[model samples]
Target: MAHVTFKENRITLIGNEVKTGNKAPDFTLLANDLSEVTLADTTGKVRIISVVPSIDTGVCDAQTRRFNEEAAKLENVDVLTVSADLPFAQSRWCAAAGLENIKTLSDHRDFSFAQNYGVGIEELRLLARSVFVLDSKDNVTYVEYVSEATNHPNYDAAIEAAKAAN
Candidate 1:
């Protein structure tokens, strides 16, 4: 199990842990269109999974916007922002934020995605903040498990790694 602490003290997350070089666990997440999207659907394309606690928060919103902007310039790459929020809410947020490039996925129906990714917070209704970049073959190339939930990830480095993998 993976253990992550929020704000280095606020909350603790315990769940399965994913690592670089490992085959990424496949999951079925709900798309904004209410369609089921699995990792298989993204095969043959570079993918960036931005796992956030919630899109309603400042950090999550910022990350989504940043990725949405950056993703527009990337070819053959699909950026997915995942959270436990409902698909309806996610769709509303995306429209309101003008997040057109990045795809927002929801894990509210079940914890299958969270469990498979090992990002589920055991004691709370939250997911550990993380970023995973996968190659076309579904092999993890870069992974960052934020030690402190409140802090943003190293996006520049993660994006660079994703580009390099492509």
Candidate 2:
């Protein structure tokens, strides 16, 4: 279990902690393109799983754009922005932002992805803001569950970790 604070109140997450060097949990999520994408689909590529509470927020939007720009320069690396938003909404945001490199995925259909990755916000109908980096073989290289849900993640460190893993 992990404790996360949102709006100055601490909330406990009732799930397992995914640590570095551990095999990443596999999940099926709906891509903005309306296609099913799984962890297996990203095999042989370094992955950045960007879990956000909602893409409507400023922090989440900024993070997605940042990753999209960074992804353009990286080879064999995929940046996946995951949220509970619907596929249509995610597609609309990416389209408006002109985001082509970063893939936006939705977990609205079910909480399988969030639950398996231990990122679900138990009290709220959203996923806890977090980031996870995985190697080509699906080994977790770095994982960060932002203690403060409203704050943006350490993108520099997460990007550096992903590059190092590659």
Candidate 3:
């Protein structure tokens, strides 16, 4: 397992750490409308799964917005931002941020997405900052488990991986 920290304090992560060659794990998450969304629903498109501790936080917001900007240029790619924030809050944040290119998903229901993706922080019940890029065939082509919860991810590398997956 990879070592993760929040505010420089170590935290234990649940589940197996995902790797680049592993098949993407399927999990259920809530859409902004409280509808159930599963990985299979987006089977045919390359996907960038942005895992954040909270959408309202500074690093999380910037991360999502960065992906939102890139989503426009990446054809057939779905940029999904997953967080444990409530669906209502996620919806409001999306509206306030004018984010339309990316989908904001809530994992508050069971934290299943966090656990399945190995980004779950046991101490805070939040996901660690990370990014995963999946090919159209559902293979994980790139994954970055950010060592610190409050930091940013490698946006350039993630974008390059998404483009290469195409």
Candidate 4:
């Protein structure tokens, strides 16, 4: 498991840590509309999976918005923001932010995506901040597990990996 801290306090992560070169795990997350979305649903495109604790929070909001803006210029890339926020809240945030290019999915249903991707924070019941980039074939090309939950990830590195993935 990756070392994680929430607000400078150590926390426990409750799943397997993902590493580059490994096949990205498939997960079932709830879309803003309540429909189920899986990794298989987006197969042939470079995927930028942005994991956040909550979309309504400061850091998470900025992270998602940054990806939403970046998504506009990336061709053949799908940017999905995964959070434990309820689908209703996710929809509200996206709409209010005018985030059209990125899709915000909710993992509040089961934390399936969180557990599978090793971002689940057992103590807080929220996902640890992280970013993952996967190729069209579902192979992970970049993985960032932010050391502090409140900090932003290495956006440039993740974006560059997505751009380079075929």
RMSD (CA, Å), each prediction: 1.4, 1.2, 0.7, 0.7
Q: What's the true lDDT of residue 92 in model 3?
A: 99
TM-score of each: 0.94, 0.95, 0.98, 0.98
Better of 1 and 4 by lDDT: 4
lDDT for residue 70 in candidate 4, whole number 0-100: 93
Stretches of candidate 3 exceeding 4 Å from the true structure: none
Model 1 deviation from native, Cα RMSD in Å: 1.4
Q: How many clashes in candidate 3?
A: 0
Q: What is the C-alpha lDDT of each candidate?
A: 0.86, 0.88, 0.93, 0.93
Instruction: Please list all clashing residue pairs in model 2, or write none if there are none.
Output: none
Q: Per-residue lDDT for 58 in model 4?
A: 94
> Any residue pairs clashing in model 3, and if so which?
none
Q: Would you list the clashing residue pairs of candidate 4?
A: none
**Of models 1 and 2, which has the larger lDDT?**
2
lDDT of 4 by residue, 14-132 (tens): 87899999999989999988999999998899999999999989999899989998999999999999988999999998889988999889899988888899999999899999999
Task: Count the clashes in each prediction.
Answer: 0, 0, 0, 0
* Tens-digit lDDT string for candidate 2 (80-119): 9999899999999888888899889999887778878888
lDDT of 3 by residue, 1-166 (tens): 9898899999999977899999999899999989999989888999999999999999999999999999999998999999999999999999999999999999999888887889888888888899999999999999999998899999999999999999
What lDDT, from 0 to 1, does candidate 4 have? Answer: 0.93
Error of 2 at 139 (Å): 0.2
